[model samples]
Target: MSELSRWEDLFREGNLKELSLGAMKVTREHFGNSVFLRGLLEYSNYCSCNCFYCGIRRDNGRVERYRLDDDMIYAAVDSGFIRGLRTFVLQGGEDPEFGTDRMCRVVREIKRRTGDAAAVTLSCGILSRESYAALKDAGADRYLLRFETADTELHSYLRDGVSLERRLKALEDLRSLGFQTGSGFMVGLPGEDDELILRNIRLARKLELDMIGIGPFIPHPATPLRDAPQVPLEKTLLATALLRLFCPRAHIPATTAAGSLEPDGREKMLSCGANVLMPNISPVEVKPHYLLYPGKICLDEDGLHCIGCLGGRVAAVGRKLSFDRADGLICKRRDRVEAGT
Candidate 1:
């Protein structure tokens, strides 16, 4: 059977044990038992776009909007680095006030502060090609822009008429600018189905993404999707395992959304195929305000406490938490080939 047909059969059979084992095998072949860690800094909750599913959407008047200045962001980075985090992911909403110039300065300062010892990844939403280039020049090592769904109509509806074509173009721009590009999607968005999930995996392969993050669709009470039916956590895990089989070398995170659904959700993901964990390093005081979905885990914990907690969790899964920059295997191979090594 063709690989596509094999995947379809695995999904249709509803045999998660077999699927998980296959994916785990692939993951071990490439990554062994080392789970990479990225420190996530949610620097802002002020998004311009009104995505139908998001808690911090601009239309949600109940959200207490906040943005961290350069000093505040730097302090957070310093704290994460001191905790032995070698990668810091600066994530925020699409706030126009924190535009290209300010972001470039922030990236440059991070590089300087860490003396180029750590990897910096930015997950701020869509920007112009020039802006991506400027950030790259400022020493940003990676970028993550999740399309959220593969169906164009669903993506447009969820994102207030923003085209999937535009999102794909932005991803292409990021790759062309030589950033270690990452993109991901929610597993159980309203209107999504098995076919769309397959398309999401195919699209990730086509993009040759360095990192792929998959999480369950958790509803926020303030958003339009509050009334939408919740998808089973099993569906999200199936998607995670399939993504691992398809993109074995790409970094996949055991997302906190998974953990929100169940006490052992993240651990379950790690056992299957996930090889990365992004512990929230954002200040505890502001974490409650940056809620993308309700019931997010670890909101009350400080950065140092989160590190220790995550370390224990990693050990429970029989995987060691790695503090290296942990660039994707594909990126590392390409760099070596380019240098004629």
Candidate 2:
């Protein structure tokens, strides 16, 4: 069968290998062998909401928690820079302590340190428009706020007090401010329907986001959804393939959550249409401590395993990580000579 036909067969038959190979081919076509890597620095474990699938819900007192200090963040960023990571993602939960002013200061310092050597992407959960603007002003180039699910009633069921309208608005808000916006969804949440997946992609395309991140629902033991079954790998790949067909050229990451659930999930996702990766650069001391979902993979493993040692994984499937500068941000940096950017 042809490439497009093969992808359709995999989805219809739910075949992992066929789907993965086709998706990988698509990924290679767009990204070549180059795997764009981002340093995922989990700045804080504290959060305000109670997502039924997260281990770090505010009520989870049993979960060990810690927040990275400004000095610590600087140190981590320095380490990542040396490792040739030009994309740094400051990811954290929604803690009141990390207010707009505080986060802007953090973003400013990161930008100063980056010095054209990196892009700062923020995944610090939901925030007010003022907070979002403050961070954007501080040289933060991207914002990754996963919507979890697109269905309104189901969205509210999974995430308290959050709605589809609010999340979609946040995405629009980020785009209007000239930030590379990212929206995400789970493959299978309770009460989720395949139509929602189509709708989610439709909305993502409508937003013209720079990135769209997604992961299968992985239940965490201290939460209400602990007993929930894992989303099958087939479903995840199918969604990924459709994303490739839909988005064509948008950046789609093969998330660690995929790797956490299935040993070879990254390779599978790569085959399906993933082009970006977020390597965990958090201090190993606290890396194992931060658990949004328990049994998250590559946390305790050395960073080499997550990126470098994965050479075998990529090569096994006819793809390789690229070590060149990346392209694609909603707002292109205007030439200083022309627009005085």
Question: Using lDDT as the measure, which candidate wins?
Answer: 1
Q: lDDT by residue for model 1 over 1-341, one digit each (tens)?
A: 98756866797566678888888889889988889999999999999999999999999999998998889999989988888989999999999989999999999999999999999999999899999999999999999999888898999999999999999999999988888999999998888888899899888888889999989999899999999899989988888888888888999999999999999999999987999999888888899999899998888988667777888998997888889899878777777888999
Residue 337 alpha-carbon offset, candidate 1, angstroms: 4.9
The 10-residue segment with the lowest total lDDT in model 2: 329-338
Q: What lDDT does the true structure give each of the candidates?
A: 0.90, 0.77
Angstrom error at residue 62, model 1? 0.2
Q: Can you give the TM-score per candidate against the true fold?
A: 0.97, 0.89
lDDT string for model 2 (116-209, tens) is 6688898877777887888888888889988777678888878876787887788778877778778878887766666677677666666666
Candidate 1: residue pairs that collide: none
Query: Measured by TM-score, how close is model 2 to the native structure?
Result: 0.89
Top of the candidates by TM-score: 1
